[model samples]
Target: MEITILVFGQIKEITGIAAWQISGIKSTEELAAKLVMQFPELALMKYAMAVNKILIQTDTELNENDTVALLPPFSGG
Candidate 1:
């Protein structure tokens, strides 16, 4: 399946891109696990996943063409 991944803050810096496509993502947990494995540094940061703007848990099943945003914690007032 294909999904759009939106990186934020340090994630963008680490990946060097704000948004991109990901394939072979069977589930949301797999996605998050692969991300952490690919970008080990991300494991140190707090993040969340949203499917088409709706927040969901990592165990949530992913759908094809879903827009999943990787949102790191924000600290701006």
Candidate 2:
């Protein structure tokens, strides 16, 4: 199962990439854990996740070719 990861705002800075692909991750929970393991800095930041452009408030199942986006908190006037 391959998942596409898209990072936005500060999250992108943390990961140092705007987008990338990962495999063998079964769910959103697993993906979060794996990302934190790979990028320890992410563990300290607050962010929202979207699966296929839908914001998720809880762990959600992921499928092959799904696009997961990491969005950091934003502020604007």
Query: Which of the numbered candidates is closest to the native, going by highest TM-score?
Result: 2
The candidate 2 region of ten consecutive residues with least summed lDDT is: 68-77
Q: Report the lDDT tens digits of candidate 1 across residue range 16-59.
A: 88999989897888988898898888888787778889988648
Tens digits of per-residue lDDT for model 2 on 29-66?
Answer: 99999999999999998998999999999999999999
Q: What is the C-alpha lDDT of each candidate?
A: 0.85, 0.94
* The best candidate in terms of lDDT: 2
Return the TM-score for each candidate structure. Answer: 0.88, 0.94
Among all windows of 10 consecutive residues in model 1, the one with the lowest summed lDDT is 54-63
TM-score of 2: 0.94
Q: What lDDT would candidate 2 get against the real structure?
A: 0.94
